[model samples]
Target: MEPTGSERGPARYEPGEGCVTTVVRVPVRIVVLVLVVPVRLVWDVLTAAGRVVNRTALRPLGRGLAWLWQTLIVRPLVWLWHTLVVAPLRWLWRTLVVAPAAWLWRWVLVPAGRGFGAAVVWLVRYLVVVPAQWLRTYVLAPLGRGLAWLARGLGAVLGALVRWIVVVPAVALWRWVLAPAGRALAAVVTVLVRETGAALGHCWRAAGIISRALGRCLAAVLRWTLVEPVRWVYRTVLTPVGHVIRDGLWRPVRQALRTARETVRQTRREIRRALFGAPREPEPARAVVPRREPGGSGTRTLGKTSGRDVPPPARG
Candidate 1:
């Protein structure tokens, strides 16, 4: 067996590899190599040429195009926008719109708005605010007070009626009738609950006792009727019959079957050999050679090292 890990080489044989693989690999490799060399050379040459063209011609042309666009197109467009559109728009706004608006606001609208606002203030004070204040003081205040006094009187009467008619009767009924009835009901429920629990517990225990007795009877019946009879039949009758069958009948039958099987197999093997000849023995595997190290033999010892200054010691 060979060592594995890094010592193993990649040239190991696959189990599926056969004469077909051996025959195909050399021709395929040779054809592929022949076809690939020219394609690879052309690809390399094209790649180098593309790099040179991009570096020498395309880069400079792109830079020139960008500069021309900025200088001739972008700068002129910006200049024309400022000169033709922005400057004229600025002047027109100051002359036609801004000046006229400013003058209208300062000269006409401000004074008119001031006078109108003063008139509006005077009219509102006399028409809306004064009337509202007078109404609140004279009419609404007295009416609200009269309605409040009436409501207070009605509330006092209603409160007395509710106390006598509803609250007192309800309180008396709860204290005298409902409270005692509730207490009696609670007591009845408590007695019923305790009795129910006790009855259930007694029933469960009696049932358990009956169940245990019944289980014992059933187990005894089964043991006598089924288990013991089955045991006796197996031991006295079936056991002997099985032994006799095995010794006198089954063993011989099995031996004959085994012999017949072996004979059939032998006959088949002989037929195969007669038709196809005996199978060839596999060739022994060749020994694997260990790989040689690149650095040759490593770490030479002092005993093996030779000295140039000293004469050789003669062997006796």
Candidate 2:
């Protein structure tokens, strides 16, 4: 048995079997990979070595360059900006712009406005308010009072003129024309009546028989017309009614008024006593004055029995 196919495998060797060498055929790309793997590994190792050298050796050499850039170049530029540019600009703005404006407002504008306001106030007081007050007090008030007085005088004069011209004339006209004429007519009627009465009296005396009858008839008519009813009403109605009111109604009212008056007086006295402690007692009557004797200089007092003048009873 020449080496079977299974024995051709490297791990598949049998006992007493002949050694068989087998060749595996590979592609060109795999063969090239076989050839390039060691070179690629060596290249990677060389790059790693370069990175270590750069970390240890080259990074330290560049640090001085970075320190020089920050110290010498950047610090000087920042210092110049702060000292030369920023500080001067800030000072210029404060000194030239803000300070001048504030100074002008504080010193010039504020004082000018204050003075202008004071001037306006002064002008208003002297020109407007003072003049107005002066005019009202000194001129207008006096003028108004004078005008009122003149108007009052004019009204009084007008009233007097109207009274004298119109009222007096009307009263005179009534007195002169109407009143005297009325009086004259009334006197003429009175004279005519008296003359007629005298003529009737003479006729009555002359026709004595007829006069007696007519006189009796006229007197009876006059009594009936004017006197009898009046007398009867007075005696039977008015007098009795008056007596009844006086006795029944008016007497009680008068009595009640008297009682009320007494009550009021009593109440008043009680109130007066309550408020003022007590009513004062009336003063004693004064003594009568002694008469002066004729031809005597002093007064003489009358005595009880003697009828002689007593030396003016010792003055109380």
Candidate 3:
């Protein structure tokens, strides 16, 4: 039968039945998944392990970058501290040593310089100045004063000697000349007086002798010639004729006698008038001095002539 299609199909196991022989043949897709899943798991695990290995390989490079950053930023701060702070401490050490050395020189050395200057000044005064002053005062001044005193004394002595020697001799010579002249004048006066007295005495003696001789001669001549002749003539001739002549010529003779008397009287009067100026009128005649005899000295002696008295001669 090909059977009826349904029933005749292979023995016909019933739906429930047949040895239940289900020949479950899973599908091809399930089969393929089950096979491919383990392979996929293994691939994923291997890729994860490869990524971790790559990260580990880059770690050294990152560490090198961090170290370079720290070096650039921090090294300048440390170098600045050493320069500003540490160098100043070294300079301070040198300054401290030099300051102490300069102070020692100022305190110890200045006084020694002043002492040296004072010693030089003392040595110059003792060596030069003191000896010069002593020589001027003690030796030179005393010698000059002594020479001046000697010159003054010598001038005074010379002046006194000149006055005594010259003046005394001149006074003695004047007295010697005047005394001889006075004696000569006195002798001349005495001679002149003696000569005058001798001349007067000679004249008086000669005049007296001549007057006496003249008087005696005149008397003798008159008596002899005139008186004798007149007496003889009168006696002889004139006596007789006297009477006759007297009578005749008596008148004429008498007249003549009268005339003669008159003439004589007139002549006497004229003579008196001539000698003593005019005569006075006639009165009684006064007596004159009496005359001495002719032989005696006439009238009066020469000594008695008072109106002719001689005066004495004048003396020098």
Candidate achieving the largest TM-score: 1
How well is each residue in 1-316 modelled by candidate 3, as lDDT tens digits? Answer: 1223322212332466222123211232244345444544454456667677656765666677677766775566567766776667666755776576666667765676678778877876776667767776898788778877887788778766765666555555545754566555554444334333332333223232333344456666665677666666677767767977878899888999999999999999899889888956789888897855744533356456433354666799
Q: Tens digits of per-residue lDDT for model 2 on 45-130?
A: 57779999999988987897889999999999999999999999999999899989999999999999999999999999999998
lDDT of 1 by residue, 1-316 (tens): 4433432322444577545445545554455445544554555557779999999999999999999999999999999999999999999999999999999999999999999999999999999999999999999999999999999999999999999999999999999999999998786666556445533444444443444456679899999999999999999999999999999999999999999999999999999999999999999999998865544454335655436445898999
Worst window of 10 by summed lDDT in candidate 1: 2-11
Ranking the candidates on TM-score from highest down gives: 1, 2, 3
Could you tell me which 10 consecutive residues in candidate 3 have the lowest summed lDDT? 1-10
TM-score of 3: 0.19
Model 2 weakest lDDT span, ten residues long: 17-26
Highest lDDT model number: 1
**TM-scores, in order shown?**
0.33, 0.24, 0.19
Cα lDDT listed for each candidate: 0.78, 0.73, 0.58
Candidate order, lDDT descending: 1, 2, 3
List clashing residue pairs in candidate 2.
Answer: none
